[model samples]
Target chain A: MLTTIVILLYICVVLFDFLPSKETRSTKERVIYCILLTVSFCVLILYSLDIKVPGPTEPIRNVIETLFKPSK
Target chain B: MQKEMISARQMFCIIIMFIFGSSVIMGVSSGAAQDSWMSLLLAAVFTVPMLLIYARIIKLFPEKNLFEIIEMLFGKIAGNIIIILMVWYSLHLCALVLRNFSEYIQIVSMPETPQLPIMIAMILVVVYMAKSGIETMGKWSIAMLSAVFLVVIITILFSLNKMDFTNILPFMENDFKSIAAGAFRLYAFPFAETVLFLCLADAMKKKDSPRKLYLYALLFSTVVLLLVILRNLFMMGPGMVGASYFASYVAVKLIDVADFFARIEGFISMNFILAGIIKITVCLMAAAKGTARLFGINNYRKLLLPVSLLAVALSAIVYKNVMEMIDFLRFYTYYAVPFQVIIPLTVWIAAEIRMHKRKLA
Candidate 1:
């Protein structure tokens, strides 16, 4: 859902926004970090989209659902 | 120089409104129905004496916290036990509140994101707010108080067309027990929970706070709460109101302007942003303060993250879904009474008795 994607992206923005200044990191290191962050964000997005998240997603969902469900 | 950084009036207003703000807006109507507002009025009458008692205790201690007062009265070991129990209650309180807010979001958005992350995110925010100290929190509450009132007015005015007095009819049809049960929860929430505000009273700008200010805040916040419940009842009716979880959201959804732009429930979401944050922050601050006192730590804020992470973890484990949480609330009302009312009253009485003996000597 678009709502889920927006929220995830917002979290990414908030998290990355906390990163120290670009001048502190080497260009190659920053690029590597960016790639990793982007991959993780995409993976979370795909999972939130319910598109069959690839990497051990079921366990995480179950753990999460168990904790926060309103239907308790 | 400001002896206390805020006034008791501001503190009282903030406490009264934010103590149970999210609960009233989101949950109270679901269980109490048409009489929900009446229950709150009953709560006010029941709680003022309790508040007065707490005020007296604060008067005696000057700047000491509840934990310190316990230690002073009971000695270190016995005092530590009381403080530990208080800490346990505080941690549980935080988890329960976090669950409530996460439930709110899950009902509205983020259906698949899981409750843990949402809850943890909120805990993080509250921790940051707590680190900022009471003044920042007080200022935020002032802003949110305005937002709560403004949204309240909007809901009442916008829903005027759908108002029905019949929804509130047949008041107190049940026997004394049911009414008392409802009234007790009414007091337990938003009212009795004002005990948490004492943590910030020493930070109040004025040392001497008049009872009138307390009355004003109580009346103002109560009116808003009442109006919100009344609106929910009128819009959703009693059965539906009591049956559903987010009655106010449903009430707002009933509003439609000019055939287009239906479902005004977004207002409830906006309301949550303010009310939800305040709820978590207040609980976190109380818990952190309690922990700091128990451990003899000079700074309570330092413990915020540990307490917050623990709360998030507890919230994650506390319930399987929403129903269990509601069930907890159902029976938890009885359990909450002692903590919310009895303990504080006992302290107040004990302090008074000690004072009386000292005077005689």
Candidate 2:
């Protein structure tokens, strides 16, 4: 139910907030906007479904741990 | 809209508030524990040179932002790649700040409230402020900074009775290596994060010196951070501070001056809200502008809504829980070094070489 509401809200945002300015935007801007919106929509859906989305900071954390091991 | 310009004072206030953003609530340089105040001082000193490089880059380029300057120095293809990286950095940083605020709110107040709605509401405010443009942001910063200062001073005064100055004994217990690392972490997280302001360098009024602006802001934030660290140390002591996720909030909780004036930790939340909004708005504006630049779009406002939504989504998924958030913060200094230090230093060098070539020609 939560996922459905979120999806509907996203569609409304894409149709209203994002689509109205499409005529004024260049092809590049429109493509970038669509890509970003799609990615965000997917992430939100995954979030609402209780799926674990991998954080971007994991790689950095691994590298830091390797370089600077905590002293006991 | 004509190019919006902010006065030097407004820029100063924005920089101070940005540095204070989440750091004030979470505590700074915690690796040194009792010595974190010293770590903050060293971090502030280290940041001066980085600020100088940033100022020099802006002064040399006159009115170009970091993205424009990157393109001018690295050529179109390489510059666009770097620009994308910078935009990603800004967006990711915005998400991290958003996550910090959401987690903080979840922990302190509204334990039962879902994180998603809180994050969405915060991002909406940030989007609205970003769409209003830099001029309004500068004005808001001035007002917010003053209010934050007053609250901080009052909180400190009230908490003085509970503080124990002797709690900071055995100052250098953490070896020199750890202390130095702590200083570096402090420098990168809050100090070097000022690199984002490079994107807004062109927004300053023509008469203002970017050098003075950077120096003044650094000094102001440094002093504010130093006082905050000292206050936390005096109140919570080293062991309590190092153990807690939000040391400053914990310290603020100790401020029970009298029966009539208790539960003043709400003021800390207010401070966080004011500073957090400014920080997120600035990052959102930078990300949107960088995206617009990437796509050759004339107006950045067109990209704000989508970029902000992406930021909110990223914030929701940034960490599994508050524990992961704390763990990531331990390594944030290392993660941010390349974007915060390496790129700006390289740009400064490139700008110097280019200026020399033009002078010769």
Candidate 3:
């Protein structure tokens, strides 16, 4: 899935950032890294966005449900 | 000049806040209830000496991280085995705790989302924090701890009208036998896991008195967690509290001060942001630090990505379903006790023996 690819990309960036370098990196490199991290997290959130939960349709039913529902 | 990393004081606060917030909203509130509050108290009392042992280890080797200490104390082969086990434990604990909260969100909020995406997003933030290093974790935790403390106090104030002390009633209804059983199992989990702080102690900026930090963190976590647990028990009642998966979230949802300002668990979830990130960051840090020491690398950050992906893969593979995950915790409570409590105690004794001999010499 697209989500999987995004996560893979994120992992790459995170691991690369961990490498200890002899010289300070260019700002461009840092920006690209940040961009990549943000994009992947965004993709992840959107992918999860479709997780719709059904709310109570009727108030009376909701009250009744709460009263009777067993502990989860 | 470079910014100083976290001090032992700040690290102590970070560990306490993160651990208290951890799974507190998920499992602890559900199982302990009024009795859960008792569990927190029990955990504190039991962990006090364990904390002292940890302090002794730190005091003896103020400059050495745990992996190196093990290497020094036990020699390379035996030390490597202990390090590997600790790494596995930290990784699995991170995954386990992540799943614990993800399951909570599934139960109470987004029911249709797969657990992986939720967990991955979380791991990313933690990876970022871990990459940044320990000082960030400390500052973030303080900001978070303050916010969560306020929310908890406000929730208690609003819910005072609803609390029924008699709910924890008949104190020993199950008797000391049952209480002790719960204590023996739950004690090491969120409480004694503080042993992981051994890694953090080495990173402290100024000298820290491990005894003071341990006692303060233990006392503070116990008090706040007990309040939250007691609130859940009185607010939800014993039977409901015992059975519910996340009694604290449910309790927070029920907070209706004047019937308009409500659902403060949302604010607390922001705090969850810090705790979740800290949990994973600390786990990764421990694993990386252990790896670096074992391989004798100069640094740990290089291992972060490989380890994160591995953790993600392993987390996905760890349990078949949320039920399996839940069952893991139930079983793991008993399984983790000896390792969390007993192994550390054994190591402490060994360390002590070595220390005494060193002193005599």
What is each predicted model's overall lDDT from 0 to 1?
A: 0.67, 0.87, 0.67
Candidate 1 C-alpha lDDT tens digits along B170-283: 887655556656777777766666676655555644355534556666677677777777888888788888777777888888887667747777877787767777777777
Interface root-mean-square deviation (Å) of every model: 11.9, 2.1, 13.9
lDDT of 1 at B192: 68
Q: Provide the lDDT at B246 for model 2.
A: 90
TM-score-sorted candidate list, best first: 2, 3, 1
State the C-alpha RMSD over the true interface residues for candidate 2, after superposing those residues.
Answer: 2.1
What clash pairs does model 2 have? Answer: none
Off by over 4 Å in 2: A67-72
lDDT of 2 at B329: 68
Top DockQ hit? 2
Off by over 4 Å in 3: A6-72, B1-4, B27-33
lDDT of 3 by residue, B231-291 (tens): 8877878887777666677777777777777777775565555566777788778876776
TM-score of 2: 0.96
Q: What's the C-alpha lDDT at position B34 in model 2?
A: 88
The estimated TM-scores of all candidates read: 0.80, 0.96, 0.82
Model 3 TM-score, all chains together: 0.82
CAPRI-style quality class for the chain A–B interface of candidate 1:
incorrect
